[model samples]
Target: MSVSPQDVEKVALLARLAISESDLPEVTERFGRVLGLVDELNTIDTETVVPMSNPHDMHQRLRPDAVTRQNDRENLMASAPAQDQGYFLVPKVID
Candidate 1:
């Protein structure tokens, strides 16, 4: 698929991008190339290919879940400007 300068301009406007007049041609050309690649991909037969979460068949390496730090809420809350009921209090910014 080919992309026109008008299409590029419309896309830029929709995306809230500022594309200079001088840069429009290059931008349009690049967009055309990307669309062409997508068009090429559409011609491939993928009826037998199953969708997968990952490209490779492998399980992710995971670490055993364990407590890495001791809870020191009392010591940390002591330095706060204001706190109540196990929660830090801050100035209300919104009504």
Candidate 2:
């Protein structure tokens, strides 16, 4: 599980990265170690394990779906430039 300097150079070219000649060796070594760790993880048997949506067992609390407030129409109409029948009026944008 190792990547060559040529492999790293080709990858850098494809990824649009500017890697110097000196950095190629370090990048190749790092990528090889990453591939090795991935190889190690491939040894695990997860066929019998149950998939989880979250690591911690927690649920969100929600309020009851009921009306809890009412709008003060007179107070709201006072702030508008023009209002008619408890509604704010705006300039017509289209016919």
In model 2, where do residues sit more than 4 Å from their true spots? 48-95
* Cα distance off (Å), candidate 1, residue 28: 0.5
Q: What is model 1's C-alpha RMSD?
A: 8.0
| Local lDDT at 93 for model 1 | 78
Residues 1-95 of candidate 1: C-alpha lDDT, one tens digit per residue: 88899999999999999999999999999999999999999899989998779988998999889988899999988999999899899998797
Give the whole-model CA lDDT for all candidates, comma-separated. Answer: 0.93, 0.87
* Residue-level error in angstroms, candidate 1, position 16: 0.7
Task: Write down the TM-score of every candidate.
Answer: 0.51, 0.47
Candidate 2 on 1-95: residue-level lDDT in tens?
A: 87899998888999999999888889899999999999998799979989778898887789999998798788757878898877678998796
Best lDDT goes to which candidate? 1
Q: In candidate 1, where is summed lDDT lowest over 10 consecutive residues?
A: 50-59
